[model samples]
Target: MDRLHRQVGAVGLAAAAVLPGLSAQVDQHAAEVRDLLGVRGRRPTLTALASYTDGLLDGATGRGWQPPQHDLVGWAGADGVAVRLLALCALVTSAVA
Candidate 1:
């Protein structure tokens, strides 16, 4: 019984440690969705926004499985527009996350 109690306590402690990270993930995703929809200042319609954001992120991840490579000039063109775009996305994702 003592061992079982110790295991339960450990499990509870582990959950307490992890819960905040899970909450932050949710909040960050919400912020990203808001930014994506150009609705940062306006009130969000939660139901629709959640679904739209999920679809958008899912499609984005599905399309790009690999990270962008470091190349001075590539498919993004000689101007490096593609590289810049990827950088912007990473910045936003980190900021929101």
Candidate 2:
């Protein structure tokens, strides 16, 4: 869990920095992550991760991305649950990139 957490945080930071062009995709990925968090089970986590991966793939192959609006450090620190989901987002972005 610790390893996964750290990896997610690190990748999330990178994703937030470099994947802004994929903002629309990121939005869906973020939503999925948030929704998954509402449930309790490993399956939900896996599903959210899968959705994020799909979003990243779509983002990469779709079109141009915009610049990210928030600073990585500041954004992640803003809210607890959000931060976690974003961390997972970061991981997915990095993995796909």
Candidate 3:
């Protein structure tokens, strides 16, 4: 593989390794926020998910999140997760509408 491919592969591996953990954390955060805000749903609407993710980004939830220590090459932060979540929300919102 070329340098770029190698780098991409490494990042992909890292993401694959961390995804389960990240998913668990995201789930926990969403559940806590939902409970706090009295949101009643197993599956939240895209708008509500976006709103909760906005709370995560804006610190409205008053909780701090730190990604795992295994260096995601600048993708290792709560902001990264929030951005990805927002993208997911947008994707789903567009698909649903």
Best by TM-score: 3
Cα lDDT of model 1 by residue, 1-97, tens digit = 2232232223322332345643344345556656876778554454544455346446655877333342322222211222223323333434445
Model 3, residue pairs in steric clash:
none
Q: List TM-score per model, in order.
A: 0.33, 0.29, 0.37
Residue-by-residue lDDT tens digits, candidate 3, 1-97: 2232243334534453467654454456555655655764644565665565556545633566542233454333445454344234433433366
Off by over 4 Å in 1: 1-18, 46-54, 57-97
- Per-residue alpha-carbon lDDT of candidate 2 for residues 1-97, written as tens digits (9 for 90 to 100): 3343353445555655555533344455555665755643223455557665456546643765322344454444333343444546554544455
- As for TM-score, the candidate ahead, 1 or 2, is 1
Please give the TM-score that candidate 2 achieves against the real structure: 0.29
In what order do the candidates fall by TM-score, top score first? 3, 1, 2
Model 3 off-target regions past 4 Å? Answer: 1-19, 55-97
When summed lDDT is taken over every stretch of 10 residues in candidate 1, the lowest stretch is: 73-82
CA lDDT of every candidate: 0.39, 0.49, 0.46
Q: Hey, what RMSD does candidate 1 come out at?
A: 15.7
Score residue 64 of candidate 2 by CA lDDT: 56
RMSD of each: 15.7, 10.0, 9.3
